[model samples]
Target: MISSNKLIAAISLAVVGGFVAEFAKPQMPEGSNPGYMTLISAAVGLCVGWRIMGPRAGRDSSIGLGMLGVVSLVFWGLAVFGTIEMLRLAMRRRFDEPVEALEMIVTIALKYGQYLAATPVYITLAVGIVISGYVTNFAYRRWG
Candidate 1:
């Protein structure tokens, strides 16, 4: 079931994820170590691209799919990294209750969203998504 569209979308989103991680690094709070952030983001991107965006490439307008992909990527990335942060905080005894810890995941994700909104990360993501969508569509038309 492998296809050129899927491969291109995965790789394209992976690159977008790395760029977003790098762009967000400087905006992070001081002394925060973003260990493996880029790698993790890229992995998330690959999964989202292949699973979410790949199959829908040629089924709709490329621009529409690209917009959806950008939204999906950002949403998944925030959820994944926010949960990681919440877990890290929980391990450090930052939360007094399990429910509080769960709530903090959303809080942390919103905070991350604030950081993204304050930077050019969205622009990069949008552009990357659009280009990837078009490219994937092209591959589909050419190879399938």
Candidate 2:
């Protein structure tokens, strides 16, 4: 079984990696097909998660790791985009269009969910998190 602390650490790394990737993604050239950032993020996610899991995982734990990766990606996306939305809303204070912070955050989060679901690059990266977990487990067992 994956220890709770290790699992949390793995998820934390993935979420932080995702945040970094999202921040840099915007500055990338339009024609650039995501470049190495995706690979780096995946590698970091895989290595850290595998390392923290401590060299062995059962079938159930392996699956759980992948699921955790997915869950963390959702969190990462929410955090990155939600921050942007919060800032955008926070800056605008139109007298006629009063907005509640809670409501705006919720609305923005929903929109971000939909946007991420439809975005191909973002989807690929999210899926990469799952693959990274599985591959990391395999690599660590065979070679490490």
Candidate 3:
């Protein structure tokens, strides 16, 4: 079993790595495909999670690592788009008329709707991580 200090270091490194990827995103060429970035980020996240979390003594943890990567992607994707949209809305200073207000509101709603369309992936990643963590912990205590 890995020591607690080592585990914490791994997790910290992973989180920092994840954030680095996230922050470097905008510096990447605009118009580049975001899907590709997402995949790369997920891969990085997985590596970090796995490195930190480690595999149980004799069990494969590859699947769990992959799930963690996916979870990171989903969580980050939502956060990125949500924050951008909110910033855009916040930056807006005026709506010309009732109709304009309605239009702006509708536009914002539509953007949010599209953004939230990926909810299943997010939910799956979230539930998978929680369940996997619990199972890993349980297995470690019971079987290790």
- lDDT top scorer: 1
- Candidate 1 residues 25-126, lDDT tens each? 888899989999999989998988889888887897888877777788889999998999999998899988899999998999998887686447878977
Off by over 4 Å in 1: none
For each candidate, what TM-score against the reference? 0.93, 0.48, 0.31
Instruction: Estimate the lDDT of model 2.
Output: 0.53
Single out the weakest 10-residue window by summed lDDT for candidate 1.
114-123
Q: Compare the candidates by TM-score and give the number of the best one.
A: 1
Writing each residue's lDDT as its tens digit, candidate 2 over 1-144 gives: 555434544654565455556655665456755445545554565446546443334433555665565555555545545555676667885223445665566666675555344355455555655555565466445644
**Per-residue lDDT of 20 in model 1:** 89
- Candidate 3, superposed: residue stretches over 4 Å from native: 1-60, 94-144
Ranking by lDDT: 1, 2, 3
RMSD (CA, angstroms), candidate 2 = 7.5
